[model samples]
Target: MVDAKDLSLAPRLLPISLSVEAGQVVHLIGPNGSGKSTLLELLSGLEVPQSGSVWLQGQPVSGQTRYDLAQVRGYLMQQQRPAFVMVVFEYLNLVLDSVQLATGEIRDKAVADVVSRLAISDKLHRRIDSLSGGEWQRVRLAGVLLQVSKALNPHACLLLLDEPSTGLDVAQQAVIYQEITALAREQEIAIIMANHDLNRTLEHADTVVVLQQGRIVSLGPPKAVLTDRLLSDVFATPLEQVSTANGPVIMRASSS
Candidate 1:
């Protein structure tokens, strides 16, 4: 569980309290400068909150050591900036290996299943350098999923994702949503993902948190919290909410 109790950041995020249970995906969304990324970093143990607490499983999130935290949570940052030369399958093997010292027995089957689901089975033997940007993100997500799953112990596996769809195509984004859903149900992973695309998050997330000026302006389920009136007031624009067969999608006009 991710229990953030009245946590505050550098100069904002005042009186913020949130609870996310296992088998759930909570989407954090707001404007570019709203400090969504900062909140994610705090939750991921990369940054410490100035006050209050970020609790995981029953302990403070920031109190854990970096190495110990990595075992319990898998965080995918907004940028896929790492440079690596390993093949896709080999990279997947490396992730599984990091799960434990005695993981060779279950490694093969786990890698096969994750790759197959991400639609990267064919790209397995190919070096990651040869794959496209979207392909690499899928590979990254597969690695994250495997790591979080391995860390589970009769409880939820926490995952922190910061704008993970930055470089993904529409189809690839769809696959990621599916994987997130399945992981919550099958592996009981609790995800707190910061998303720049509010439309996508509103449609799929179990909970939505909005940050503004480093503060949480709103937090709730999608339909209940995201309103055209609220968006207009916060974004200083006449935002439109269009209802599609899938769900509501917000559209913003350009200033130019």
Candidate 2:
């Protein structure tokens, strides 16, 4: 469990007191600059909160080395530009080889499987900078996957992705979400992803937390909370919506 007891990050996130349970897939949905990433950063301890405490699994999560916290959680920020200029596979290897695995072949095979699932198998030899934005995002996500798998046991991983679906096409986006769903179900990892894909996020999420102006506007089950009024109020725009055969689809109205 991640608890934010009156957490505050100045000039960024408004003070918030929120608690998210384990095995819950929650999406912090908000418009750009609505403190989604700031909330994430504060929770992940990338930025120190101005006030309050963060408790992970009932223990205070701060006052420790960043490397120590990495063991309990894995955070993927909004952007991960290539600073090292390494091959994609090498990066995967770097993440994969960090943990002490009993079998070399098994480790390599697992890394390969993760790369395949993220749809970056063909780009294994390509340098990160040489690939497109979406491809690099996948590679970085794959590295995250590998890192988490390598370090964490089942039922004890927190995957916090800030705007994960940003650069992907529809198919790629689906794959990314599917991967998240599988992790939550199969590995029992807690997932908190931020995205603008309201429909997809709602469909995949167990719960949705709506934020506006750094404040949590609403929090509940997706179907109950994703109403037109909530959408319009949180986004500060008139969002047209419909409950279709599938699920709630939020649309934008164009002035005609």
TM-score of each model, in listed order: 0.88, 0.92
Model 2 quality (TM-score) = 0.92
Clashes of 2: 0
- Note each model's CA RMSD in angstroms: 2.9, 2.1
CA-RMSD of model 2? 2.1
Q: Which residue pairs in model 2 clash with each other?
A: none
CA-lDDT, candidates in order: 0.78, 0.79
- For model 1, which pairs clash? 13-214
Task: Give one digit per residue, the lDDT tens place, for model 2 in 1-256.
Answer: 8888988877677788887776789999988888899988888877888898888878787785676677667889987685678888778766655543324766677777888888788998898789988998888888777666633333246788988877899899889998888877877678888888888866888999888888888898888888878898878888766767875677875556
- Choose the strongest candidate by lDDT: 2
Model 2, poorest ten-residue lDDT window? 147-156
Candidate 2: regions farther than 4 A off: 97-103, 150-156, 253-256
